[model samples]
Target: MTRTPETPLPSPKECRRLREAQSLSQADVAAALGVTRATVRSWEKGRTTPRGTKRDAYARLLTGAEEVTPHQENPAPALVGAATGPVQASPDRAEPAPEPPSETSSASELAPRPAPELDPDPARGPEPELGSGLSPEAEPLSPSLTPDQAFDALYAFCAPALVRQTYLLTGRRELARESVERAFQLAWHRWPEVAMDRDPAGWVRATAHEFALSPWHRLRPRHRNPEPPPAAPADRALLDVLLQLPPVYRRTLLLYDGVGLDLPETAAETEASTPAAANRLLHAREAVVTRLPELAEPKELHRRLAEVASAERLRAAKPTTVRWGGEQRARHWTRAAIAFTVVLIGATTLTLRTAPDHYEPPLAPGATVYGVPPRVAPGPLSAEELALRAKLKGETVSGPERLVPEAG
Candidate 1:
């Protein structure tokens, strides 16, 4: 008997890519392979390898996918920078920096072309842009793109997806929109720093996630009221489970599973150590699984997250609006700070002018005199007392006579 050669499975990333490319969910793949979704998830995540018959089946499936779909070794360049790092300007030139592109229409002009155009390959759809879990919809930041143009492109590309993400974090459409807008506004205010940062999209994402999950948001009158739950029962259940999780856990889960960030990237974004991040991710997954056993697989949870986010119309503000708002806010804060400084200076000056030059010792607290009693004033005499006084005056005499008369 001749032994057939075993089909080799692709790498973990390729396994996920091929499945997503086929528009097949983990459940679908699981059903086809006659395994649980968790098994499929582990295979994609490279936690556990398939063995024997299952291994052969998985290998064959991926091999078929590879044959059917065109392989793209280098999927797409990121919007912000290249694989090496951000493209920097030459230093030797004595020329002044180029004027920033016009703010007006910058967003519309530089906005990334729609999904279908930028990423023609369906397999590359879920691959996230620099820091965001969403695809890089915008063109890469070339030397020709001005700072303003680049910022607008980034905002236009990431804002929509970010809004949806924030909604998942907070379950409030308005708060989600506000969070993304606020994040972009801050990003614009610190354009130089943000532009130079390795992951500009990520910086904005962290800021937005922070803002959306802020406990202070509960104090906002508008945010005090919970947003209406998802219309779909399944979506509602998933969102409820997500909301039940601690903010840190929820954010970790969203970043890792929903955004498709690698473990280290998720850890870095969440500001936790890698081990701690892994622990959080585990707890978060367990929590979700406990609530909704159907979402046992990370891919399934990711799909549900996308579904819940998409069901709501969580639109972000225009890039111009975000930029203008940031500027206005900066101006407002600047003016307030200046005014406060002036007031403080004036108060200090006034104190210096009116104050005594020498140090005046504080007066000692008044002491109580040991023997002295408070003064008691005589009150007006009553009628019977007046009569007694008149009688005593009329009967006045020498001391001995008075004593004898008093005895009589």
Candidate 2:
């Protein structure tokens, strides 16, 4: 029997990691590929798919070979910073500078061949340089980003994809745009919190997704027309297939395959456990593959969606107006204080509300207690008991009311 095939390995996120592992910047890759930095950035950001010769060059540059050939022992450098780790002299010694895509490539000058066999294990592949588990949704944010820089960078880099995702989820352009705007506006005011997050884009994305699903956006005034039907039947069919899946699966699919988050970040954004996210991705793929036979491979679905639904190139995000200091800042903090105070009070009230109503029940009413009292039992009153109490006197009657000798 034929063995099952291994999954395809190159993803936009993986490509970014690959280039970073080699310590090559976008400019470096762009220079080598005869493309613009924007193009290289687009590829890494999943904004555009590399095609034909471009794909060929990108694949080779990432592999640190002339091509992404079928081979083992592909070294994934550890995610240690360049300063901390000793350099691997061999990759540099073995590989020459990435040459400008010819007439042909002269980096080792090998004849280009077809796309290589898919690596079965990406986890075993080359690691990134900065740190482990980096998602495409982030870049290292500098401490110096001004208000404009922060908002613009996030908007330019992430808005197109987010809008596409929100569109898919809400099925309305107006709602999607509204959601994206609202999320970024919130992020702008709280850029400190957002930039510090592991997935700043995810913070905004989740907000937009949640906003899109709100009942308010579903109203007719807030709704807008979806894109016109695709001329291609295949594209049309894919949309229909995507819509048929459950909402959870649909959103999960959009984030994982559609938006380029790894399982963990996807889980965080969707509020799912990692395993649940994985399961949703699996089931979503199964559903899509069932409908679209051409997308039988998970990577095919990944490839299709990673190139955002349209070919639009989005510019930086610009919110309407931002007031940075003075009263604006004071108002922000004051509102925050008020909000915190309210939450504190609400929490205290909740604690009070849920608390048991009854006071520690009063020891039955008029109850009395005695510590293991003087050993007293029947038969006849002991000498001590007789001394302590006389029935006629007001002394305590301790010994079980001395057994009475009646007129026998």
Candidate 3:
């Protein structure tokens, strides 16, 4: 007699656990492999083993292992012929029972066909859930505003602070100004989306900081050169020292100290946590103190504050405008006058082209006309009026009439 090999089966609990670990539903797994839920359940319950390619697929999907052949692990045994009945004696002849279907045969028999090639990484992994689980239909904080209105409000509230922040971050006056302007332009386009957020100003500040640190600006040559250094007064020296710090530390210190924002507000503006902002401020202060020990002393700091106030006042009191030269003003007016004249000429030309082909003089002040004349000025004549008039008058007049004989 010959014995047949029993097929190995998978545990149902293991199948369910693997599916759960990968965050996949039975339906999802079934759909991916083109198999029905019942088929998967039957395999898991050990009622029947997935044979051939299906057995290989099962191993691959569940264990993430390479496909294994059935013959390698379980070879077919030889079969024996039955003994003859009655008195006849016979030798036991052994033969292989139809080499139990090959591994390929089992795979081909699966209801849900296996893929030609299996993927090592499927989209069944766990994902981090970051935002609140509120439905997308939740109400926004404010009614939506048009892009223009949102931009106007944002600019009015944040432009001044943005300008100062940019200067502190970059140390280049022109670059700082340009960065603020560019940030506002971008904000104008994204205003509708941004206006719904809790902190639009924070959004703008982060955008401005990113613009200031863009690759183009980072790769630009610094202002220093080998030329002889320009002489600078003590106050200018102090300002220069303040500008030389790295952008992150400089911005963190200025927003807290100069702008007078609380730690939380500073953190929001810089897009950092309160603790991070505090650490940045502390490091910046320490760096400055180490560099300028005398100014860092408490007593000296107070004295310097008084000096700073006086200098600020002097700067504020200085005249804000300077007169341009007469020649410059003349040139400006000349350009304006030329532009105006060109516009006027264009308007007249367009009117002539589009107007009706008759001439009507404007009514003079205190003049009145009650009735139509025999003929109206030939229906709003245009720029070609003179030539038209000459042609018509020539046609109306008689040819070569003599007036000399009329006196007799």
Candidate 4:
């Protein structure tokens, strides 16, 4: 029998857009398509194309998602774990599979969960409509909340997950916690700016990631000695491979694969061009695959990343603690600056008081005389004295005659 002609699917970008338009994450699509999340990612990235039944299923999924609501606003994307079996098309699309527990979930769960769409605190009163760029999930803060309240909410929502992510980056629980806390502290200090940001989570994430991967961490006394590796051999191996990658490469990989950020978003966060970020990710993946051939597939790599991150009990300080610390730090620096200013003013005043009003010309250094008189006159004086002495000696006589002569 002649093979049935295949129906063409949309371009990779269009496929991603269609899925995103429905607010379905890669995992949700992957689960519904009986493929791994990495495979879905690759398909979107245009690295690999789905074949045969998989292609048909993905096309149907996209088509169904598109036809459902052409003009409706997309809800905040829901993160879920991958499930087996092909997605079935019904009168109504099937509901997403339930997310697994945090401990056993994939790396996507290690990423900060989106904030609830609706404000939970009724006491804060109703909130104004959010701007198009600023989604409630991306930025959880309601306009009614005070700056401190907004900061706390954001911190509470993002800090725990950020700590876990940073731990995966640095392989040190303390550093991870510190990084997240510091990032939030900074965010709190710059509350107005951060609150206004479209993606506050992204802002904090970039800061925490930067802090976690800082070269200065290598100089820290505590970090000089390596932290204990994961008890599981596989986890330890995965962490080792991750740490072996250069900081830039490691960061790019983690943001894309581990944290589940899109390539463009990863590039933006990393402050690299998209192509550069892609190259770094590619090289990083290649290096990881080289060390552990088993992780050639992206899904396996993501699972291992989740395991490594979760293997350690990484905890973040409370939002209150972070806020207090940030305020204290700000106060300390402000006081120090004031003290420095005072000291500078005092020194300037003292210098002015002690300084001479007018310039005084310095005395010129003495010069040696070129023509000095010789001592030849001393020889002539000596000759005259000798003649006078001879004359006095000739005048001497016998005792009585000498006495009469002396009397005369």
Candidate 5:
């Protein structure tokens, strides 16, 4: 019996493109395929191939073909889970038997389905245009505020807790506010670049922590009374407990508890390795407990710290202004540019007006000169040579016209 052809498996690049085109993340595809995310990544990277049941499933997924149900006669599930040592695979197998041949199935139903054609019919409608759009003035209004949308959204999400995290680090309300503001200012300046990072908030928090810990504030003369604003009655006891901890331990605890960063992020902000950060967080908790015997366990300390930090209050609060300051910067640059241009034009005009006129020969054909001479000069020639040159043009002839020089 003639075997049915399988759906053509996609190339590695095509596989990745199809997955992304379907709006599926690698993790999403991995979950669907019952494989590790690294396996999916390797497939996309051409480090390995999806084969056996995996290829069939991938094809079915991408092509929207009928999935091989659990009850199917020839189910080949979890091929990726096994035979995963290498990318090589056996030759393509025939498409599996159709739906176990239902009682109402016609003879034609068992035959392989043809691949779908991509191009639309000529008569259906005009071919879709590419790079086509209405004019800038005529185009429909775009979704509101495209500029820095991702960064703006991120800032909106993280600013409050970041400020709180800084406050916890510095123990000074105004300094915390200033540090957070300075960090956000840097973030705004590099939003396009930083927004693409996997964890932009980590970077911002790290920067804010640096700002809070900077020694410049110490070098400057300070008033005798430079303590932070008095905490609320509810928070005073908690703040008193936190102030006694060292800066590293305090910042590490605050980063994990107050800002909700993961172990990696906490380590990153504190400039420690993951194991080191974990150790620091443990020691910090132990230190906190040693200071305050009322808190029994480390988890209890974390819970109490979270409550005192008021993460929920900060998370739900209206964000302080997420200003990028691009407009103000643009305005300043515009004024400076205009002033520079005016100066340049004035200098040029003054030079043109006061400078002496230069005698310039006519330009060659199709040549145009602006505020400069057109270079032109005859070759050096004797008066006798000039008379002979005129003779060469038939303006005059001294004697016989020499076709070539007699000697040299």
Candidate 6:
């Protein structure tokens, strides 16, 4: 008996069942096809069909499944070539299926969906347009200050805290002053990006700590030489010992003992977790105690630290201004202006050299000989010699045409 052909098109129920068997949801299928879940649902419900390119995509998907699972109930038919025999349905089916509609010139049509709406929160503004709205005239609400201004404001706010921290880190009155200045310069450069961050003070403190331990600051002549060490007063001798410690131990000890920063605050400034900072501080305290027996005696170290703290407060309270004006600003602008002028001059020279030359002036007239007789005279010649001269020389000699010889 001749069997009826299996439908080329899958029914909505069959499509849904096939997808479910593969453990794929409508959203998953839609994502794979770069379409919306609604589109996949419509296709499964037979309200709409996947068409043209999408139809080809559907065929590919089915073929992929058949390749992977050859024994699956519904194997895909050969789409490109003619079938050798009639198509058969799975034997478990109770009812016979209808014949597939003949192929048509027009494929199933997919309708375009509306774009998704964005979140309504004001904080969720559109991404900034690059190189746009950055003009000078575009004023920010707060009358946008420069990096220098922002740094100055931050320095003022954090100065007291920073000075105390600086003294703790450097163990020197003069070194701490210099370190804080250097840190402020670095902060001024990054202020545009960092000023609004939640932990700007911590950033400054970290920067100052790094500056204190920098090669330029830490590698003093005393550190390099073992013999003929530099002399210091008793108080400075104590500070010098603190400064001589390894950077990690020094900072850990300073944060806890000198600055009185808690473990968490120290961790925040140093960019370490709290437990790590606490461990470091513990080790540092032990090391300092081991090296300085006086500091190991609790009351003596506390007394020295108190004196240092007092000195730090005095330094912070004094009016100090960083003069970015005068020679420094002049030097910066002078270098810039020199560079600009050099470029301008170079451009002008290039333009002049490449340009065509025109209208060259005539050579100047030779000088006039007003008083001088023409350098040699136009002298007279004898007539006796005229006849002999005429015969020898190629001249038509007239009767007394005196030969006026050319001057030598």
- Could you give candidate 4's per-residue lDDT for residues 1-408 as a string of tens digits? 112345588999999998898888886775555334655776787754554445656787787733332212222221111111011112122222212223222222222222123332357653221111223344324468877777766665566556767777888888888888888889889977777653566678788888888888778788778878888898888889988888899888877666555454456567775456666777888899898999776655655665566446456688888999999999999999999999999999999999999997765679554488765654444777889877777774642233334454
lDDT of each: 0.63, 0.53, 0.45, 0.62, 0.51, 0.48
Residue range 223-265, candidate 2, lDDT tens digits:
5445565445665677778768887888887765544443443
Off by over 4 Å in 4: 1-140, 365-408
TM-score of each: 0.60, 0.45, 0.35, 0.61, 0.43, 0.38
lDDT leader: 1
**What would the per-residue lDDT of candidate 1 be over residues 1-408, giving only the tens digit for each residue?**
112344577889998998787787776665455334555675787654554345655776666642322111112222211211122322221211111222231111111111121222356464333223234343346758887788777776677677778888888888888888888888888888777654566678888889888899778798667777888899898889889999999888877666655454456678775456667777887788888888775445555676677667556777788888899999999999999999999999999999989986665679555577889999999999999898888874843253334454
What is the Cα-based lDDT of residue 303 in candidate 6?
46
Better lDDT candidate (4, 6): 4
lDDT per residue for candidate 5 within 1-408, as digits (tens), equals: 122444567788888888777777775665455444555665677544444355577777776564422112112111000111111111221112111112232222112211111222355542211101111122111236454554455555445555555666666766776777777677777765555443355567677788888877787555235675444654566677677777788777665544334344345447766456666666666666666776544334444554454422323222235453544555687899999999999999999999979886878988866798777997699999989878678743475655975776
RMSD of 6: 30.7
Best by TM-score: 4
Better of 2 and 3 by TM-score: 2
> How would you encode candidate 6's per-residue C-alpha lDDT over 240-348 as one tens digit per residue?
6676777777776665444433333445556665455656665665666666666654334534544444333324332225535223645787899999999999999
lDDT comparison, 4 vs 5, better candidate = 4
**What ordering of candidates by TM-score runs from best to worst?**
4, 1, 2, 5, 6, 3
For model 6 the local lDDT of residue 406 reads 100
Which stretch of 10 consecutive residues in model 2 shows the poorest summed lDDT? 80-89
The RMSD of every model to the true structure, in order and in angstroms, is 16.0, 18.9, 31.8, 16.7, 28.0, 30.7
Q: How accurate is candidate 4 locally (lDDT)?
A: 0.62
Where model 3 places Cα greater than 4 Å from the true spot, the runs are 1-146, 221-235, 268-273, 292-408
